[model samples]
Target: MRLEELISQFQKKDKKAFGKLYEMYAVNICGVINTIVRNEARAEEICHDVFIKVWDNADRYDPSKGRFFTWILNIARNAAIDELRSKSHKREKLNLSTDFFVGILERPEEDDKRDFDSTRLKKMLGKLKKKCIELIEMLYFRGYTQQDASEVLQIPVGTVKTRNRNCISQLRKNMSAS
Candidate 1:
């Protein structure tokens, strides 16, 4: 049977159609969840939960918005994010959206518990000027693409690469001087 036929049957709550869809896409969905959650068991659980949610919200899905697989991909990604957020809420109370960079830069207290290399990393980071440090931090530490850094810093994207090269050169010069 065609994918559209399977999806049509699934939306109508046909158990066999859902089963066939699960057999076809379970691994892919789990893989997507695993990339975000970094745990196989958790990924599998999320995969199952996501399908349940998909079934529950079947009426809301519109083919005009996206393909069936794309819709499922979004659902899987969102479920993985929710799982991570729930786990984070249980462990500690911190707003990751706002504090991601600040948390990386500061310890906040002596007793604060985190497995991050802040002290030695801070010293190494001290070698660069503020802009160079920010750029390097965004690119390497925070995983910002050149285009992202450019937009955030209000500089041309082309300048990001040039400045990054110069920043590394400065870092090398500072290291040799020390």
Candidate 2:
């Protein structure tokens, strides 16, 4: 069957149609998810969740918005980003035993007393908002795809590119100023 016909059957909750769709797209979707999450096992779990999400929200898929592939590709990215956020939050909670602000502020000083470059990077990054820093970290330092960063930041992909361009511009300006 054609993709639209399969999707139509899927929307009507046809099990075999859904299976066929899964068979066709599951690998690609998992690959997209894996690009963000980086763990094959976790990517597999999140990929399964994305399909579940697709099944649950089948009625919401409007072809005028885009193709079925794009729709599910989006769903997969969203699930992967959510998984990243959840993992980050869990790590934060697990590491929350700092001695309030005093230790939080002093531990770095004690640990990196000789690292002037680290200090300079912190000073330079101080001008950027926490959001922009997170964006940079997610996109560059953490090896996220542009699509993954866009979904994680809840911004359009075009906006992510523009903001990244502007951020890089400012970073160069700051580095040159020092």
Instruction: Assess each prediction's global lDDT (C-alpha) against the native.
Output: 0.73, 0.73
All candidates: TM-score: 0.52, 0.52
- What candidate 1 gets wrong by more than 4 Å, as runs, is 89-178
Clashing pairs in 1: none
RMSD in angstroms, candidate 2?
12.4
lDDT of 2: 0.73
- In the range 52-147, model 1's lDDT, one tens digit per residue, is 998898878898898887788778877877777788577665222323333445556453445434564455545666788777656643446789
lDDT at position 62, candidate 1: 91
Each candidate's clash count = 0, 0
What TM-score does prediction 1 earn? 0.52
- The sequence of per-residue lDDT tens digits that candidate 2 reaches over residues 1-178 is 9988999999998989999999999997886676567678998999988999999999999988899987898778677767777775665532211122222233566565652235665656656655566666566434467898888779999999899988777767777777
